[model samples]
Target: MYQVIPPCMELRDHVSHFWFASWTAQQDRVQPVYYQTASCLAELAFAFRSSELVFASVQGHSPHAARYNAGGFLSIFGVSVFAYSLPLLFDVPPAALSGRFCTPEQLLGREGALLVEQVAGEADLPARVRCLNDFLKLRLRKAAEGDHRIIAAARQVMKPEVKFDLSAFAGECCLSPKQFERRFSACTGFSPKLFDRVSRFEYLLNNHRRFTTLTQAALASGYYDQSHFIRDFKQFAGCSPQRFFALSGY
Candidate 1:
């Protein structure tokens, strides 16, 4: 089973949501699960029965999902960080994390280890979420404020049906195109063009039900043609649009 819960009010600015999942094996065998690439956000995940906590990056260039094995019983609690919000809570730059998974100790030092122990001790999911919230609050107190302009730009990029002209958008933000590209990459781990591409793909995924056909979905999401849409859909999702829709039960 999988579920998503909204972040607490205090965490809304930096965190998107808290997600949980659990699965039990029907037999003594490993099951494979493919986690699709998300090019616009970062994730911090804790496994209740394992030490390998995962901090996954915005996979801007990766063409395949992250694969994992599951057997017996497994459970996970994850914090979904909003785009560009990682630097606000952790010292690591978003660009440094692209297409990689870092351990808690690698990202947070000794404190991360202690947090792992504390979270593992809690058998209840809500209590574990509270612990994570407290940890994030402490980190926020010590961290510098993030630039709001990037967040604003991200919002604009995500709007459906908007024509994304990077040069024009950069000018509106009072930045040269090159300057905008550099700062945007530092903040979101993706160049403005790449971010727009990913955002368009995501829109297609989320709103496929609203369209009568895959071609319509592609065109409505801003792809210029079927081939362009299919290429990007395959690159980001690791499957053709038809297969992805089927797998996702859309």
Candidate 2:
């Protein structure tokens, strides 16, 4: 079974959703692997009663097709944290955890480790949700304030319809270009310029149905030329636009 719910109202800005999923061993064997795609969002997942030391993950954007193979019976509860929310939620920078995961106990030491145990013992899904929410809310209190300037910069990148000039936007935020680049990269795992490229590619991918033709899609995505568009998509999706769309059944 699979289920998803929104975070409590207080955590909505930083958190995208909370999810739960489970499958039997036979089901796992039937559909054993899944591929990941380029994404700006970070995710945190917890495994329940699994053989893998109750796996905990806090991961960042993936640039390619990372694969995961299913094993045994599985149940997982997780949250999707917005990319900019890294600064609002964790002591670690977004770049620090990009493309990889670390144990909760390792990341937060004793408190995180204890919470993992408590979650395992919690009676029902609602109780477990509360346990996780309380932990996050408490940590949010201790976390440093998120840089609204950088958040705004990310927003501009996210909205490709707006004309964006990296240096000009930095000036608007009262940050030097270099300072803006550093802080944006630290929070988003991509510099403003690169994030812009990814955002355009993301638009192409998400709206693949309308972009049925390669030339039209590339131009519509704001790329200067078809070659540049294909190059960026290859890097982000691990495949050319044509190949990716065909395989994805677009």
The list of candidate 2 runs beyond 4 A from truth reads: 1-3, 27-31, 49-54, 202-230, 240-250
Looking at candidate 2, the ten consecutive residues that score lowest on lDDT are: 26-35
Model 1, which residues run further than 4 Å from truth? 28-30, 49-64, 71-73, 210-212, 248-250
Residue 61 lDDT in candidate 2 = 65
> In order, how many clashes per candidate?
0, 0
What TM-score does prediction 2 earn? 0.78
The number of residue pairs in model 2 that clash at the backbone is 0
| Local distance difference test, candidate 2 | 0.75
What C-alpha lDDT values do all the predictions have? Answer: 0.75, 0.75
- Which candidate wins on TM-score? 1
Residue-level lDDT of model 1, residues 1-250, one tens digit each, is 7888888887887887888987664465547464565457677777644434333222223324555554333677878786687788777787777777777777788887887787777668888889889988888888898878877887788776788888887888899999888888888888788888888887887787898888888899999998999888888887776777677664
